[model samples]
Target chain A: MKWLPRILGAAMLAGAAGVGIATALEAPAGDPQVVELLSGLNYVPSQSNIDVVLGEGAVEDLIEIAEDSSIDSDPGLRIRAFRSLGQYDGNPQRATAASALRRAIADYGAESSGTKLLYLRASMLSLAAIDGGNAVSNLVTMLGHPSRDIRAACAQALGITGVAAAIQPLRARDLIEPEEQVRLAIADALFLLGSKG
Target chain B: MSVLAATAAMLSLYLASGLACGGAGAGAPCQSHSECDDSYQCLAQVCSPKCTRNSDCGDGFQCNEAGVCNRVFANLGDPCGSEWDCEIGQSCVLEHGDSNDDQKLESSCQEQGEGGRVGSTCIADDDCRDSLCSLGHCSQLCRITDDCPDGNRCESIPRVLGVDDSAFFAGCIEDTSVLSTTIAMSESSGTLRIPVPSSAESFAIVAEVSDKIHLVGVTRVDSPSDFLLFRESDSFEGFLANPIRYARSKEVSTLIFPSNGVQEIEPGVYDVEIEASLPPFGPGTAVPKVSVHYKLRDSHILDLTFYFLNLEDHPCKESMGIDNLDKSSAKNSDVFQDEYLGEIHNIFGYANIVFPEEPEYVNLKRERPDLDGITDEQDLRDLFRLADNEDGLAIFFVRSLPSDGVQTLGTTIPGPPRTPGGPSSGIVVALDSLCYRSWTTLARITAHSMAGQMGLWNNRDPHGITDPIGDSDSSTGNLMYFGEFGGTELSEGQRRVLSLYPGLR
Candidate 1:
């Protein structure tokens, strides 16, 4: 009976190692220091340092935290993650970060409208920063969001992208935007783009 | 013959004798030299006396090349060469006009009356009658208290633009009145209207919420659709988007109407709405509280409490060692007070700082491991809770902050007024970075952070966004510039926003 109990304990240890191996194969591990810095509040490390420390795992880790929908996750951390992704403006992984942020627009869910709005705003900003030309279409769709704040934020994000394609959609939205604030935002975007040209 | 008729006949006879009329003297209003007394010439609609130099003409009159003492209009906006050339307002400000021609912009007398009356709202100098608009009002220029209207005081204005010493001026500003109240949150979400009195020229609302509430929004009751929204999980972007309306932390928020004193804020009812989460234990839980501090008028006295944090065991302690302030020495030392407090006073002439008690040596590191570095919001909230002081602003001095580049200094943007032990508790200054610099530099950093907490934006942000205050220009010398250290000059509009802080008494 003692031998049988020992064998069962060994079996449990082996299963745990197998699970760890599976996770390692799925994604590269992030440096503990990088994780600690990112998890903390107030200070954000520079993008160059993050890339040097985490290498290719940087974008994957950020995307995972940003897309996390669990109730236990801190909403503030998710927002920070989105912003950090935006710092990778010139990196090759920026495209991947942008795609993840775009997906987060639909995947991220919260009970409170305030939380949802904040997440959407962060995603919009990061997307524009990462790939302005590609982000134009996604931002254009959010111009029709039910919340006026979201629509206004979308228009502002479109202007920040500085892509020529954003100008036409913003001008088109200008005529149809119902809210005064949103309409003003659309007009500002058009003006910004027009000035850039 | 009545007495009036006899007096009129004598005056007519005197005028007919060819002797200059003796009724009007120098500086008196006159239509012609014949209406002035002997030896006095009528110039620019006023009687002027014969003179060789400016000194012989007396004050408010300058000797012209024609050897006559000419009356100086020297009202606000009138061009002038020196203070002596101006009237009661001693300031002869050197202005750079809008004309591309460089010579058109020159020194002009700084006084008030062309745009609007005293106490009227204004956007720029051109909008006021006085040619000098300060704190959204047409403030009269003055050389002394006697020059100001009753109930107002003549205060020195900080020179924010150029280095010219002649540009110095003083303005008349009113004192402040602060009112505080608490609103009980009865439900998950609801709106409450706070009445604003007609006497209020400008107002600020600071709301400190309980743990349960996660969001708050403020707006004029008449215009509910365009409200300022503040969430518990706000980031730097949130604060930047609504600089005067949002706080960095969740437990506290602020909303300043006409933040830069440029916009017109109507005196009426303002609506505040809060959204809270239900207590896990269910309905019988204690109701959440939202403390509100409403301030009216501008120009105030602020109290400060410095907490010297003990970072003996801090992981990121500066290599040079922490310079822990001696509590008793700091309180009694005149040099220490003059270094920082004097700089603040220089920038905001009406702002007075008083230390209610000796500085406290606090050991926040014992409460939390990461407190020595303050890397996150929870850590800051914990530190503030441990060193909570409701009497005034609580400034925590730490060894170092775990940040990159310019973020070594951390503070709540627009701190909650009169609230203690919350997320927006106080300010944290990294002594490591400031130890080697002069105390005046420390004062600049402190003043900049304090102004931010009190409700002021940088003159210009990275996105090329300027503050709503029309008087504030983007210059490195400005106290509200984005840089960590520089000049300590504060614009009149910046002072208005600083005075609106609820913590100011």
Candidate 2:
């Protein structure tokens, strides 16, 4: 009869462990069917459980580690956190706190065909932010990203930001960025801002 | 070593249909992780800790990410270098950005590929944050766009503005994240687009390594009735390589194209096609079924994507392009001509059931209500329906599907198209093709130069719209300018075609 208490304690512990797994199972389920689920976009278990999913170091984080600019730089953990934040895009509260879309772009970029897709989700909160209307300040950081795609994408975002004052600055310096694509992208941004070519 | 003894070979195979092993370093003469012992998880066939000597990484590979051994997964068509590799059906080619010997963190296929998400830009792994091959791209996480950042639209470059993050730099109408990218070779407008060959429409047979030609477009045709535009002597890295049409321009596209000024090129896979005739200036129309020469270059170096013309965007068939594939039957080879007939390309080559993705005729029949593009099985239906209905239309369709997205030709296929997977669209597009060559060659010439296929195919090759418009300003007597999508200035070759057949368009 005394064993019952110990069994109860063990049961509680088991339940505690299952809570984490249950969150994961429910969280975007992380790309089931032999596919690696990206962290921070979908199936993050849940917001409450996001920490746990990230605790295990997700797939997207590994990609960051693999692609970082600084040789031998391990950006995996940082990416995991950012990806977790990105998953919040579906939720407004999450979007405001982490701006999952911006977090992702800030971390990675949309230079290639595949990356451009991230914009689909980013468009959501991006529009929301624009609606809230502090866009120019929001995009300022993105303008400096090393990737031209990101810069170009950010320029697009600035166009979405819709703040009129941004046109002059966008046109003045015009992203004297190194890459031609960046220059073209900045040119595109200015054009989007309705800057006279 | 003691590590082997201490860990006592564990037999952990996930036995499904075939033995699925977790692998404990017990395999021999293996090549990649897919070749390990029944119970071994081989990274590079080492059967222990996922790598043999460093060379086991194949070429352009390095070990990283918890000893998970990374390797480059593309090289010609058969480019998978790992066990968990994205084969023909899998959109898993890692898009490493341009490598700079000066930069330590430049793109390297050395490790696992860039399996990231769509819309995410990447300079290094730091950007991806969470490595998932999303939207046909590999990336870390959404960085700059408000999708992941604060409420911001169009951010300026922070470093220049003392704000050092993605928000200050990039912007767009939509939020975005970059996975990985290469240098944009040609201008987005393709101003440097070179002209077609001198005798682009004619047929020429030459046997010199330096024989020169220019490619206008390429379509993979099983029938041997088109043009032969590629040469064998130059263009390829290896002998016995498939022929490719060479593009002549002032600058090189990748390392693929030769030096500028001299249009002369070597042999390799090229999309552009050219025909030769001893009478290079055109005017001869006496021939019936003249065999023009061409080549299909291996543009595998191009980055791949998973997301493509979403149903909601543009003239997507599933969206508004075609309300439903109600199986319409029309008269003659086209609306105007009556020479030959064409049907769907059959994917129902049952004996050729090479990949899981290749759809069955039955499956296609079920999806007819929502079908937009053609599958192998649907292709067969096209032919069957054509012959069955006697529509007598040469149903020439072109698609810019990536080799790894749908069923792969030349080699065994992997599977059918997985929407929102592996650059759901093909990068190697058969652009600016025509159902009836002679009927639409002029418009097609204009379209091909613009990089968009205006063909009335089952599916539209968006790459047909590869170029931007507003090239010149007006389609003048001699030259045509960009018109919002693409710009085309009549080159020497094109001028020759126009002069030879006045009022062709």
The DockQ figures for the candidates are 0.02, 0.01
Q: Candidate 1 — which pairs collide? A: A41-B376, B112-B130, B113-B129, B113-B130, B114-B129, B114-B130, B115-B128, B115-B129, B116-B129
Against the true structure, whose lDDT is highest? 1
Model 2, range B1-505, lDDT digits (tens) per residue? 2233312332222222233344334433245656564444454334544543322333334444444445434533333322223212232232233133221111111223433333454433334423332212222221233222222222211111111111111221112211112212121121111211211221111111111122111112111122333333333342123232322211111111221112244221123322221233432222111111211111101111111111111112221123322223112113211111100011101001011221111112222211122223323222222211110111212221111111111100100011111111111111111111222222322222211111111011111121111121222121121111112232332322211210011
Candidate 1, CAPRI quality class derived from DockQ: incorrect
* Positional deviation of residue A144's Cα in model 2 after best superposition, in angstroms: 3.1
Instruction: Give TM-scores for every candidate, taking all chains together and pairing residue i with residue i.
Output: 0.43, 0.21
Report the error of model 1 at residue B499, Å: 1.8
Off by over 4 Å in 1: A1-197, B1-176, B219-249, B263-265, B276-288, B296-299, B311-323, B332-335, B350-370, B404-411
Going through the candidates in order, what is chain B's TM-score?
Answer: 0.53, 0.22
Evaluate all candidate structures by whole-model CA lDDT and list the values in order: 0.55, 0.27
How high is each candidate's interface RMSD, in Å?
A: 26.9, 28.7
Superposition error at B72 for model 1 (Å): 61
lDDT (10s digit) by residue, model 1, range B1-505: 2223333454455456554444576445568778877777665555555556554554455667766655667567676654446764344544644243422335678753446654566656676655655544555555454445556556543222322111234555554355455555675455655444333544555544556245433422232224443333335555455524443224555665656645555443455554443334322222335555545545355667777654442222222222234454455445445554454444444233323223344445344433544434555676677547765577776644433112234445666667777766677775543323345556666766777777777776433467767787876566666544335556667666665566776
